[model samples]
Target: MPTLSAADVRAALLAGAEIALIDVREEDPYAHGHPLWATNFPLSKLELEAWTRIPRRNTTIAIYGEALGEDLAPRAAAVLAALGYTRVHRLEGGLAGWQAAGGECFIDVNVPSKAFGELVDATRRTPSLSAQEVKQLIDTRADIVIVDARRFDEYRTMSIPTATSVPGAELVLRVRELAPDPATRVIVNCAGRTRSIIGTQSLINAGLPNPVAALRNGTIGWTLAGQTLDHGASRRFPEHVDAERREAARQAARGLARRAGVARIALHDLRTLESDDRTLYRFDVRTPDEYAAGHLPGFASAPGGQLVQETDHHAPVRGARIVLADDDGVRADMSASWLAQMGWDVSVVEPVDARERGERGQPAARAPQPAESPTVSVATLAEWLGVKAAEGDAANGLAEGHASRAGAGARDTRDTRDTRDTQDARAREVAREDVDENAAQRADEARREPLAERSARSDDASADVAVIDVTASANYVQRHIPGAWYAVRAQLRDALTRIPRARRYVLTCGSGQLAAFAAADLRGLVPDGASVYVLDGGTLAWLAAGLPVEDGETRLASPRIDRYRRPYEGTGNAAEAMQAYLDWEFGLVEQLRLDGTHRFEVL
Candidate 1:
């Protein structure tokens, strides 16, 4: 019930005050701007149902929002207090206070970069690489991997020949898949400074393998350095998508729309659908961040990944026709392909091409048009979709346990009985549709993760476990589980500074998935008697479990012990050492031959 000023919160954060910063605002408002460290848990959802997202009950939580004056903040505090969570406090002046204090806010479709930036600043190390140096290295065909840390569309526009497209948010999830070999030097970049700077920092902060650094100044710097840009289109896509391919993908989407039973409404049909009695499931398959930034009036977000991951969760209108909106045909077309493959009743809502029908008032066609069916009765279709939605809800644990149990037999036994009673006569004709590559991509990512990582988890880990904090110096210093030792997976050898590998280690991360991977990788690297285990659900889960956490960047003791900086044991390559540092800084060391320089093959 007490309130803390912005300065108070800032001081706590800066001094390593372990606390959960909660932004109690609407999703849209939270998306626009929230404190750098805050995680959104809208008060509206808490009004309807308790939130399961926040990490812990006993955590020292600081809640803030512009709407705090509108009773939302107090109510949120009450909910937490009633839930037996002690130490829930409100921000004295809400976001206004934080912003007034010169604090920063962040916005992104996925993992907000502002939070990642804060982590980077905490370590006193900047993620950077010389543009000229990386280009020169690439010219030699050395063992270097360049990654374009921008959206796919951005990559399509322009990128280095050696770079591959990997969006900033997806970097943590997909980095290992792209570069499995630890010896390969990794370089990340974006169009300008912020993303490239922050993206590289995130991976480093997360303790990923491969000596990683950001291409300073990104594509602009590379271009200034006079490097050639490859449009990446020739990297794959066929030169021309023939009529046959387009028709097949279109038909596939149509068939899916038909089977799903969503009315294949055209863009101009919005008025009619709004007036109809039946419920509608309108979707926009663009990025969630884009949707949050701005979207069509009637549509809800069904970003490609979430749509495929939870089709039944979003669209329950089995056999009902669906309406979709996309900026260009690419995303919609890509999504349509997947829905078509899944047997949804779908159709492309083509825009009225202004060129074909002049703007002011176009004349009607001379030929008589066939009258469409008067609202094809979808009452039965609606019911079928509802049943499917209900089933999906149960599968995802969104439904009540009691309701799920009761619906179990109803699905199987009743489905069989209903099938015997109905069937062939009711079979709806599904128009062929095209497949959405986005959907396929989503499906591929969804299918990639094993079941063990996807299931609901608990935080009651074993006691006195050796928890290795597998995060960069910045992330470790920002906030982490108390007593967890830090290890930079990028600098594994250097990580062996203060901590010995002889102890039993439980790797901990923001999410347990990456930590699990690290644990597996470290299995053979540690001493013979030492053992490693993953902290189930990582540090986030640990926080949610009401466990203790502390702040301050985990860093190697100052006065960096330069044990390996002595004269090169195998090859006296002082020139190589100086050259490697210069190339790393300026971006063209490989071209300058290492004459009488240190040469140590990392492999």
Candidate 2:
């Protein structure tokens, strides 16, 4: 296989050449450490995810994995080649090689976006209020309007006493309506520092008339400071934008994007980029509902706020061209400013006719399908699970640990305790209705034990059929077939060895697609040649069938390593870890200086 030395890859990154430095290990391993620009594209999900993520077949791609045992680079490279990626190369010596060459290997996911938030804070001196100060202001009924700069779901999960969900990108577009009186102070917050800083800076950049400040350290700091977070906040920004406010916001946003060096390209310019060698991604940065109503052809609905915070997932290949669009004009430019600051070559499409946006709803991903889809109906799977119609009661959402790969915050549990005077560190930040320690710990520990070598337990020790749900770990915790064990698609081969032996094993994902592809891998791993089948339509079908479902980390057949647990994302994350995460954010401006690869020009 062709190989690129760590030095050569580093040079490409320094020169801003379009490249996808891919880590093919499972998320857990990949999250442990990786180069600044490396995108995690696990070997297991390569065929399923590569086309959408990489997009350009001939983009320079470098694949790597575990430094020593069971290297996955060659495996991933071969798969990419099979999937029509023409410029795939193995990283010379893997992650360890990058480390040896003095390449920085940052931990946690979405480092670029987070680090940029820190840089914004450092350079702009973004104003912020401590949790205690914010709490005081709230208790006194201060003239302030708090806006949560996260998805509506996240804001609903846990928010400050009176915060409204404005999200990051909408700060410019919707802040006018939420706090129409210019005298009202506007406080922007997210689960942590990244969105808080970015969201606050966005308003500052657009010159919001009112004084603005971020809720310092966000909810994590709020918890550390012993303040109670309100769970199930329903306040959302009004979607209606009057022509006057929309035009005003469009002018401010266009100016901000221009200052950040984001290009304003016409449809013809986008066409030019598409025909070039560089990989280009065109996205409509608007609300899902609006995107569903009408959007440009071939544009995907990636909410502006989410697309900025999750650039790695949306467009994994660093240095690739990105074009953003919106009918109202504000969302796309607001999103593009941040992407450009993060060193992405980004552009906002010049205003197009509202009539030209003919596409409705999200465009389906053209991922590779499994050769044979051996199917099981959701009703049949529910019967197999012997599920009864009993779901655990949820105050806000279920458990504190939804295994978001430790990414999204709302999926985690809410911390309702008043910790103001308490010194107990054992106090969980998340409300846990039930912690099934045995079930969760057993599956995690037993994964290394080959087969049924240990004493038989009442569960799964002697079952005729085993159902392995391959949904995103967070979704699995939300709802799943009662008796199923949660396993990530990337770790299915190793995961099956730990699960109790059964006559037949059925695999499933959110939709049946992932399960279908994974079933093929399972068929080869079964020692007894057990029949492997997929639940047609996956878990969504199970819910649609009116079948019973359960929630929480009851059965974790695979570890939640697919996503790096953000310090503020889990129930039991240490207070010190949260503090360290803040400290890390504080130091990122310096890290950015040392890296020397970024093109950030904060105005």
Candidate 3:
């Protein structure tokens, strides 16, 4: 396999060339450290996710893995090559070589977003308050409305006692409704820092009347200060904003977006941008429920706040063009402004005509198909296995028939009748046993244990069980069971090897659908002695039951190989992680210093 030097990769990024620096390790390992622009593509999920992630087969893909002992990059390169990925290469010395060459190594996933947040703070000196100071205000009953900038689920997990969930993107548009009085102080927070900073700055950028600030260092700082956080909180901003307020927000956001150099393009220009031979990501920056009601064709639902937070996950191609759309211009304009400052080639388009709207559930695009596919349909593979089994059974039956015929020739008619009856009775017994065994297998495959039952089992001294949360990293971080381990369904086979040995496995997702699929996959991979069950109704059911939930990434039965941690996510992030992240962000200004490729201009 061909190899690319770390310096060469840096040069490509600097030159604005299209390249994918993929870290082919599990999420947890990948999160420990990687290049600033590197995207995680675990070797175990290469076959399942590579095509979709790296859609262009001919695109340059540089694979890297653990620097110390084993090298999974070479093997990963082979897999990509087999999949018809034409331009695959291994990073010359792996991640260590990159560090040796003075290339930045950042901890956590979504390095781009986190680094950008740090950069924004460094450049703009975004205002903030210490967790202790904010807590004191709450105790004094200050006129403040804390807006949690994270997702609703995250807010539900842990939030300030009186905070309301407004998310990041919605902060600007809805702040007027949340706090109409100019004297009311508005504070934004996230699990850690990035969203809090971004959300706070967003309101400031839009020139909101109220005094706005970030909860310094976010929930992590709060925990460090020994502040108690509310758990399972459900307070949220109103679903509907008045038209007059919406118009005012649109004007404010548009001005800010324009000042930030976010291009306002038409549909025709979008068509031209799409034809430029560069990657383009179109998203509707609205709530999922609103998006489900209606959205432009070819646009995926990516609520503006989450999109900014998880830009890498949504559009891994750093140099790609991102076009955001919304029925109301406020959301997209504000979102585009932040994305532009984060170094994305971002634009906002006017909402499409109602006739141009697509169905609610359609995806932005289909997953890419592998070049030289070696996969067969499940039905076909099952038929093939059945045929092979039947062939063996037929041979055994023939041998038995021959033996019976030979014996029959030497026996009387009455004796032959007895032999025939005995054989018939034995066949019936075997058939009944087969039926019973099949029923048992089916029951095992379809079993769904309720959360209460699973919790009880875990509490039991003798029960041997493992609980796996197969949701995305962001979701798992927001809230999950006390002892659940996070894993991606596509990489479950490899994850299972790392998970503790157990007689039974319980799988759960946001809802039970993905968990059900994962459970079936686990059953096929595990030994017959091992059983798998899906959580009935998944984590939502757990919440409904008012069971306690844990926050932050914890108890990894499998390595946190499913998602990357944002520098701002979780509590007690290492000092090294924070400094390394800032260093990488500082380097980006210089890294993009020479790259004429990014058309970014900060207001």
Candidate 4:
């Protein structure tokens, strides 16, 4: 019941304390970097199934997650104790404390998939170069391409001279697209930090050819260094546009929409349709919290990922068009991008011009002029931003929809009511069959186990057991223990099919590594009262212990990569995005370094 410090945990490690170090971060973050000798049981997943993974019922369970430096440590400790972990203890101060105390975090690059991700980040390293350095590099004609990695509008507002707009996140994927010449030296920059630093690191990790770095401190740095920023750039439409700006962007967007053959609807159309309830799905593709606070009264929020992931589920009207709302042009554009790609007859239903606030009263600031001999057209930029905004919008929309759907009106009620009823009926039937079948199967499995071994794992956890076998399809079909079925990590969603209505579920993976990931993913799908678990050793250990082995080919094939494509699909020039992303990333690193708060761990 005592709290454990990183130092205390270190002592435990040295003394060989029989404790499992659990990372409570999301699966992707865990895959990126985590404590050595620690197993991942994402906190989200652990809340529901702690008993399944930590069934010792007596050993101390230690939990840690991201470096927000808050009370998650104690909170997790409390949750564990409540779950009957008995002597649950918090890792004092979490991973940050562990790192500060010279503890090691581990990164395994052996797995090609995970290694690829790290490489993408590492290869795109863009350290922030001082303004003097940038000026010096440019003056000397040192083969560098200066990229303004902020929004194109931001670039137009005020940016370093000769800088092109390349946003973050797109950095890794769009590098070559921006600077086609492999030998070009790339300088990425943003208004400030975080995005720039992450962007730069992402490219370096991905292994870009050119030497990349950021403009230290970004545009602020440039101005502070007595370097002039260009104010003659064209404006990118604002999220909440004023009358003048709104008119400008509207006119511009109208022209573009006409070119794309898309019809634009006003807010009146939105309101008129809202009351009709005619299977029309209105989406606000903004951030999750934004969608939650308040949205157009009739809209069902569907952030980008979920919107796209369950496109057919959320909006079955393949032919039915969608109206998008966003204060910022970014969300609308990004969400539209994805919806367009998903074959939705989608268009940015720009907010009514009456609600628009033009930039008339705002102080005159530096804005980018339309390029005289421009390499990229405004129309091209609009298309790019529009698409990205749509995708981003969809993501934000999906996050909001997820949060709101818990309380919102039944979406697709007409179709879902029958499906829900059928599923419920099917669940009851399945439970009845499972009870009888599992009872007989349990008897047979009981016969294989040594008396003592059976008792060791068979505490109440196994009685009303729900087994989720997280492995390749081939592995599961070949010879999973009787009821164990496949829960592919990537398509882990499909695992919902096998879930029993009346039992606690326990997930198993190849080496216990993926078991934790699966359990975390499947946590949401478990029935209202059922608990979930992960087999400590997975199939490897089960087989190592001489358990039965079955072999059948799995249906698993690398799923079509097409689904992973964003809706507002564009073949983003990764270099440009990488540059923009690095601009923010390096800026963040510099700030963190200057503030003396960034904690880096040697893995």
Candidate 5:
């Protein structure tokens, strides 16, 4: 296999070349450590995730994994090659080689965004209030509004008292509504450092009249200072956005976007970009409901706020081009500005008639199906297990019958006739039992219920169901069933032990597909009496049904290690984790010195 030395890759990065440094390891392992800017594309999920993640077949893709045990780079390269990726190469000596070449390794995903946020704070000297000071202000009932610049679900999880949810990208668009008075102080916060800093800076950049500041150290700092967070707070920005204010925000964002080199393209130009050899991701940065109402064809629904906050999840390939679309130009413009600053070649499409565009409810990109894995239904496995159990019972019964008859003597013709009649009667009874067992199995199969029904059932006293949300930790924190517990699907074996014991397990994911697979796995693992079923339509269905959802890493059966939360996320993170995270960010400038592949220019 072709290999690229760490030095060469570093040089390319420094020279602003388009390359994707991909780490083919599971999320847990990837979170442990890797080179800066290395996107995780696990070997187990390569076929399913590669197409969308690395969309350009010829994009410079370098695959790496553990240096010692079970090298996955060669196999991962082969898979990519099979998928029509022409420029695939393995990283020389794996991650160790990068370290050997003086490249710095960092923990957690989305390091680029986090590092950039730090860089922004260091340069801009963004104003901030300590937890104690903010508390004093709140106690005094000062004229201020605490804006949590995280996703609404995260805001709901744990927030400073009285903070309203207005995610990062939305800060510029919605600040006017949340605090119309120029004298009202606006305090923006997130779980920790990045979003809070970025959010406060965004308002400053937009030239909002309010005095903007980030909550220092965010909730983590607040907790260390002995302050309490309000859990399950539902305060949010108003549903309606002011049109005139939105237009003003758009104009301001356009200026910032231009300064960051974000391009404004028409539909025809967007088509040209799409047809090029380079990969292009088109997204409609509107609310989910708005996108569902009407959107351009091939544009995925990526709410602008969440898209900016979780860019790595949306677009893993570092050098890929991204196009943002919105009916109101404000969202796309604001989102594109941040993405451009973070080193993506991003553009905002001109607003066009919604009637001319195709509408879709969900994302258009489909995960690639595994080639050799055949679908196995739960019913089939259940039936197989049932047959095995029946056979074992029959074998034991035959042994007992033989033992009981071992000393029997030969009977007269009349006794033999009676024995024959008894045997016929036993056979009829066994057939009836078989019919009843079959009926029971069919009834159990029919009980597979959707999330809505299960949710309703959960309220009943007689129901013994446990909802297992099998999504990444980050997603689970964003939004999930009020009482759902998080578990990584691939780590279900270990996760199973941590989950609460229940008579039935209802598995769910972002969609129902993974949930179905997880449910099947649960059936094999659980005891015979315990039941497992997939939550048809998953959490999305639960939300569609207007059921309550809770935020935060609530009810974690397994360790939150499934994802490496940013050093700045949540309270009570280890001092080492926080120090190590800051050390990693501080060293990124030097790491960039070695790799030179990053084309970042903080505006």
Candidate 6:
């Protein structure tokens, strides 16, 4: 593969040339440090996600990773090449090389969004309330309403004592109804800080008469102050706002977006930019459920809160133009304003008719299609693993292909079966238990017991089928098949050497998409007589089938570099790590100024 020096990547970014500065490492290590514009497209997921994320196959691509001298970077370049990416090149010395060349390395994820929040706080002097002060108000039953600015599921996981989930952009549309009286105090919070600051500032920008403030440092500050959080809380802002309030909020939000240099274009005007060579992303900024019911022809569903939190994910190209659509007007404007301040050429489509919202659910990506691989249903795989049904699960087999099939007989939380919320929740549960020694030990013991003793079929039933899980290491350690081995997709040939050879091999991952590609690759690695098949729908399907899952690191086949525990997430973080995270966030604004690539202009 050809190489690009760190200086070359820097020059390309500065010149505003179309280039993808990619980090091929998993998200965990990628979050620890990376270049400002480097989007993470892990080697483990190259075949599954690269096409949708990078968009143009022939675009300039500079790839880097911690495993610079190893087969990792070269292997990644080869994968991209196989996908028809013609200009893929390795970063001369990787991240350290970038640092040596005076490229600043930012620690933590979402640097662009969080740094912009700090700039907003500094310039707007966004008002805030300490944890103690907020706690006092809650104790006194004062005329105050606390609203969480995170997603509804995140709010449900942990939130203030009595906070309602309004999410970020919903603050303007819903806060008026939430606190009708001008004297009613409103406080906003998120897991950490950015969303709260943006949410609180959103209300202020909309010119709400009510006194507005952010819960300082959000829930992190609350916990550090020795306060408690309410788990599984379901309080939510009213979905239906009074018509008069909605119209008022729309005008207020529009004015704020206009002040921030966000353009307002009619829905029809969106066509003019479609033919431009520049990347243009059209997203419906309404809530997921709202977008699912109806949305623009080619637009994808990206709730406003998540869109702001993950701009690099939604639009990886830094110079890409973004167009947002929301029927209510409040969400698109509030979301677009923040994107504009963060140096995005964002616009909102006006007068979007009900007719335009003809397409439903999420839009499909125009990814390259590899030859489809053979698959075995989750129940069939379970049966092959010598796990007999418990008398009542005779009809538990799900049909083959995609999410809906896997979700059909979902054992628990079926409503959220296909959403990222369910997947994140499952991953968190696995991570949390893996860290708990008592829980991990108990799970290990349970899995160690024989699978043959209670099996209706002979032990030979499982002897010939070797199951390999290609999901993240954290998820693999927490939940997997009784005898399945865990391995990174990139190192399949190496991993297969370590595992006992079987006549037939089965591969699985989070949703089976990655496994499908890995299975195809595995077919080439194994002997001619050996059979390779993907577990239909992957691990999620296995979970939905309510089949037995063995937790703990039973069949260790790979290193655990796939997931990095964020200091801000969950409740078991050490005091030092949490405090250090807050301190790192505090210094971001200074770093943004020093970097000089960010074109942020606070409104």
Candidate closest to the true structure, highest lDDT = 6
Q: What is the C-alpha lDDT of each candidate?
A: 0.47, 0.74, 0.68, 0.47, 0.69, 0.78
Instruction: Write the candidate numbers in order of decreasing TM-score.
Output: 6, 2, 5, 3, 1, 4
RMSD of 1: 29.9
| Candidates 1 and 3 compared by TM-score, better number | 3
lDDT accuracy of residue 346 in candidate 2: 88
Predicted model with the maximum TM-score = 6
Off by over 4 Å in 3: 82-84, 362-365, 368-602
Candidate 5 wrong stretches, greater than 4 Å: 372-376, 383-562, 565-597
Rank the candidate models, highest lDDT first.
6, 2, 5, 3, 1, 4
Report how far residue 14 has shifted in candidate 6, in Å. 3.0
Candidate 2 residue-wise lDDT, 90-147, digit = tens: 8998888888887777777777888878878888999999999999999999999999
lDDT of 3 by residue, 1-603 (tens): 899998788777777777788988777788787777888776644654565456567778898985325688876887788788888889998988988877766666676776677667767888999988999999999999999998776676678889999978888888889898999999999877789989998998888988999998777667667788887688989877878888889999999888777898887667888643577788888887778787787787788998887777677666678899988789999999988876678899976676666666634333323232122222232222121111233333332332232222212111111122223333334434444554534322322122334445534532355678876554566566656777766566667776777776777665544565456557778767976766665665554333334557785544554544555444456656655554555565555443323334445
By lDDT, is 3 or 6 better? 6
Q: How many angstroms is residue 507 displaced in model 2 relative to the true structure, after the best TM-score fit? A: 2.5
2 against 6, candidate with superior TM-score: 6
- Candidate 4, residue 321: how far the Cα is off, in Å: 1.8
Give the lDDT of residue 149 in candidate 1: 61
Give the CA lDDT, 0 to 100, for residue 82 in model 2.
80
TM-score of each: 0.31, 0.83, 0.68, 0.27, 0.72, 0.87
Instruction: State, as a TM-score between 0 and 1, how close model 1 is to the true structure.
Output: 0.31
Q: What's each prediction's clash count?
A: 48, 3, 4, 91, 5, 0
Better of 3 and 6 by TM-score: 6
Which pairs of residues clash in candidate 3, taking residues 3 or more apart in a chain or in different chains?
Answer: 26-561, 27-561, 28-560, 28-561
Weakest lDDT window of 10 consecutive positions for candidate 6: 393-402
All-Cα superposition RMSD per candidate:
29.9, 8.1, 16.8, 27.6, 17.1, 5.3
**Model 6 residue pairs with clashes:** none
Clashing pairs in 5: 10-595, 13-596, 13-597, 14-596, 14-597
Please report how far candidate 6 places residue 587 from its true position, in Å. Answer: 1.2
Tens-digit lDDT track of model 6 for 81-172:
98988889999988888888888889877778888888899899999999999999999999999999888877877889999999787889
